[model samples]
Target: MKQKLIFFIAIAICFSSCENKEKNQSVILKGSIQNSNDSVLIFYYSDKSDTVFLSGKNDFRFVLDLKMPVYGYFRINKKTINVFLSPGDSLELKADANRLEEITFSGIGADENKCLSQLSEERTKQEINYEEWFSLDEKQFVFKSDSAYKAQLIFLENLQHKFNNLNPFFTKTEKARIFYTYAESRIAYERSQVFSANSKQKLSPAFYSFQKEINLNDSTMVFIPEYQIFLKTYLDKKVYEQEKNYETMNDLIGAEFDIILSEIKQQQIKNYLLHSVFRDHLQFNGLEGAKDLLALYEKHTTNKKNKDEISSLVKKWQQLLPGNSAPEIALQDELGKIHSLKDFKGKYVFIDFWATWCYPCRREIPHLAKLHKEYSGKNIVFISISIDKQKEAWEQMLKIEKMPWLQLHTTPDAKLLQDYQIYSIPRFVLIDKEGKIVNAQAPAPSEKKLRDMLDMAL
Candidate 1:
């Protein structure tokens, strides 16, 4: 009897120890890759929170300490491999070591397989739609050729929606990344056709819209090499120079330049490139070469008469940089009560420049509301300035959203717009307690980025 009792106690202890060990253990991912050398595979988490690097081996095993289930992208140079994992799960994966031609993942209730299958279906649909659109005869126009541009815009919009829906389902970044490549390829193919100067005028808007769609769909982290190549090929020097519409041309040039500059690291390389492009090629010298053009303008262009005008405009652009002083503006609130920068001297101020018609601006309301609630009575002031032409829309939106922050609007004055260089909507400025600009393109208050800034400021 004594021996039996001792045996029972030992068994209980062993079971309890196993349970505790399992609770503490990390999810194990075991895999093998064939025929690859010195190639690195990087795993990017879905939240963009962390990255893991793995080397190709005959057999590879990785243990991940997961706090929760996650979707991650695996990449070998430019090629992506996507996988899904759950906490306390184990996976066994196999892949072609030579060319990354085939990958097999088994584990965690076939989550990875399900994600890949969905991605495959979406890709097939995208290919079919693209092929069908491109195959259509250019001469066949339901409306005037210029009018048909709208049809292409509609098609691109639909494509964007489809891609957005499909992207989240992809467990691997590679599969999700192919959408941008397809967009680039389609745009490049379309741009290659030589049309009469007159016909090209009609097609230009469509081409621009296509490029915009590609940019809008692109994930900030996922750098598509094909898109970069397409931009370089289609958007040449002459395209930037010959375009007369400064606003649209500036956008195109800036977007393309930003794409290129994002890849380059050395400050000298960037300054040299900017000088060659802006000063030498485009003949645009103002705010061209400086790392923070707005600041350079503010410091150098100060003549008292032009101080208010040029300083404000330069400060606006400066605010676009990460750490810059917020542009100072005195405006009246909805009740016609005047408020100035000095009033919010000792608190962190987030000034959002927006309009009622702007969809992106409106989308930020929920996020702002949540932040306001979370940081209620904190040392932060959230203010929104509307550049809307109609006060009715702004007023109506304020009422509908029940916004608690200080809401102000300016009439449609060219001077005010020019003064602030207000060329874009949904811009935000963050000001610290010292009334200095903390961030110019300070993201909307709803973003975790804003929360982080608040944490630091407070």
Candidate 2:
């Protein structure tokens, strides 16, 4: 009797384990790619992202725990494939790295994915020729957009019909995407007419009838890429309607933020716009006058993620501010000799961050050469740091150009680039004689402002 009872308890425990395992099964996105050169694939969903590293054999997988179905996209290098993921989905994908457009799906969610692929391809075929569309009059533009919208909507409906088991969330969001895309084009047309062409002819009331359909306060649609774009265009239209004259770019940004705070009531939309405005400001002007605006942003926005990101950027920018000691830069020369910025401490330093592959950087070469020749006798040193991954290309270019300034090579991921916040090529920096930063984002070698700044510093 004791042995039988123990056996019964073991069977009950096994059953319980099986039940828990079934309940805990989340989304399993596994894939294999042939001839893939990338190290990782990025999957983005609902403002969150997950990365799966490719194995030695180029197989990858991501197990995601999701509460509801969401429309997301997988990005490998420059190629993006849309996907619909739901709880309990166990989807598998197969693709050739060279031909990502031909990716195939299997297992659960296969029908919806195949349909999405068709939808993407069809939409591409129906994409508007913006140049041609812009040349048309308001009436013609509206007619063209309306026709396109109708065709796309029909295509989506057909996809839903074909894929009988399509997720409702995916269907709803796809429909929203089609509509928002049309609305964005309409807004773009209106802006072109009013601002670019300066057209005074009153447009027909029917032209803007679509605006009535736009719910500016809707927070549920924030994750849709099309809706996000439409919101931006809509915000620009609202801001431009109020005032167009601004002395500076930051002034324009400030006006945008004011409109966002005062007009937008939805918490999510308001937070998104606020974060966007501040980020743009930071990108363009770097941390100048950003503290006050940041304080206001912290006061208004409840999004801890965006707030933390902005705060982190602010701290990084603080290190690059004028009068602060310049970030240490150590790079190797053509002969593999390490050169430090501190080696030229007694002289003012003008750095030109360039690459052999950058057309704009090459274009500035002659202008930089002229400055170097002119300032050869001055208390300053001109240095060209080549941010090229292939050292051979940089060395070959150096041999061809025979640039007179100190030629150095550094990889793209160097600490020097991050420390100085060098996002783009052909960047210039000016350092004082005492190793202090005069301007982290100094004027270019071709600019008269650079000459003036140098003269004043000397």
Error of 1 at 405 (Å): 1.2
lDDT of 1: 0.57
lDDT of each: 0.57, 0.86
lDDT of 1 by residue, 1-458 (tens): 99999999999999999886666456777777665453444466633434334543466666777765555656554456656666666778787755554677676535545445455445544443433444444533212333434433444445445444333333234432454454455454455443223334234454444445444324332233433444455445334445445554345545545544565454333433333333322222223334343343234332343335444444445444445455567888888898888999899888888888889988988888788788889998888889888888888888888888899888667455544455577777778887786765576766788788788778
Taking all chains together, each candidate's TM-score versus the true structure is 0.38, 0.83
Clashing pairs in 1: 34-97, 82-172, 319-440, 325-437
The predictions' CA RMSDs to the true structure, in order, are 24.2, 5.1
Q: In model 2, what are the clashing residue pairs, if there are any?
A: none
Clashes of 1: 4
